[model samples]
Target: MATHRLTELPADALKMIATIAGPVHDVEMVSAGYNSEIAARLHLDNGTVFVKGLRQDHPRVWTQQREADINAFTQGLAPALRWEIRKGGWDLLGFEDLGGRHADYSPGSPDLELVLQAMRYLTSATPPSGVELKTMPQRMIAHVTDPADVRFFEGSTLLHTDWKPDNVLIVDGQARLVDWAWASSGAAWIDPALWVIWLIASGHSAADAESLAALHPAWDITPVRHIDAFACAQQRLWESIARADRPDEWTHKLHAATQAWVEHRG
Candidate 1:
């Protein structure tokens, strides 16, 4: 559920963007993103830069810094960070305008292969030095049935836990991940585990989605009990999300998908 822009960018914010990226020839508000108070495409005199930001006082403002800090390490897997500005009570980031469509995760879709390729590339990434990142166990601590299950999630691999189709773009026959706000340092198998939920939501059954996830090399080495614990944790997490005030249809769909996954794992 994306929050739509309710007003134009503040004058001071626009001025800061101009200073960093040259004059803004035009502004096109991008309404597809869930996070950020402002998401827009700035058509600059030099080039187009996609910018997303949040007011300094916003509760999730820290995510703006997280995305900025992780962009460099993402390398070819994500859009390059062009510039960043923290001014006029706002934290803004400009990124390379990757003209790409959201990836298709439907059964038999060709984009699935490219998405796996991107996942393979992501497997080798280690968190950048000096950047603090949450580990899988830390993030799922509250959701797991047994505290000991958290041990199954520990690893050094950098993970992109959010694999929504919109977060992955199909560009030039490659899948590029976006939105590193929730990036975590976790087990290599965890990324594919998270992706399996999205695949089921997009029409694949639990078994089918898992078969696809098995394409990742990490999947083979992960213990079944570890994945089972992770699936239970996901079920609890999505259940809470779905119960929130005015939860969106997508949230409920994912909850259903998680329930199916947990059942299949049993």
Candidate 2:
């Protein structure tokens, strides 16, 4: 079973958002990202939107503004925004929740087509001018990876910094990429690289994930190579947060398994 911890927004903050959103029931915070909060379905009676608080320290927060701004200015591209409030460290972003189901993509599964279709559209669309990766390379590398090979991926006009099944949902056989916090100026390969890694982490066999990554010819390096380099970035992070001291037989074994896989690849 997957364990997900959620945080409830403060009372004052709740009312502050209700002022603009109208009626709301409750909200839950995700464990992965500090400032991201998802309001439940019941809370969205007439209409409700996903709310994300910005953090100055977070590299992707600024790109979120770019996403909102892009969606506001363009048509039929990104999730539509209702309003943006200038809060202290980060702004409050409220966007209409587009109805979608948690995407289930795996090796040899057609669900991947949904992700690919969306990838094609996003890479095809033009992003706003004067945009670059706001996240520091070192820190970004720390979270996922910063292989020397990744330098070849720079110079993309518009790219989603992060992409994974959890960050995407399917609606009417099409994929909608959410969680724009990682939007950046890198090449298109960066987004798909992130998605391939998620596939491997979520129980898909390594060979299968590698095949999926290779399907995208636009990417400079093969998905398998990039996945190997970046795999430690996320696995090490989980161990750090859980404060794992050693490898166990079952749960902490995840770290052990990751290590084994890394060694096998090397």
Which candidate has the top score in TM-score?
1
Worst 10 residues of 2 by lDDT: 33-42
lDDT of 1: 0.90
lDDT of 2 by residue, 24-76 (tens): 77564544432253333326557557776644445445655665666643345
Best by lDDT: 1
- Residue 156 of model 2: what lDDT? 41
Task: Provide TM-scores for the models.
Answer: 0.97, 0.69
| Per-residue C-alpha lDDT of model 1 across residues 1-266, encoded as one tens digit per residue | 34545357778899998888888988888777588788888898777988899888888888988999899899898899998888779899999999899999999999999999999999989878888789999999999999999999999999999898989999999999988999999899999999999999999999999999999999999999999999999999999988888987779889999999999988
Off by over 4 Å in 1: 1-7
> CA lDDT of each candidate?
0.90, 0.57
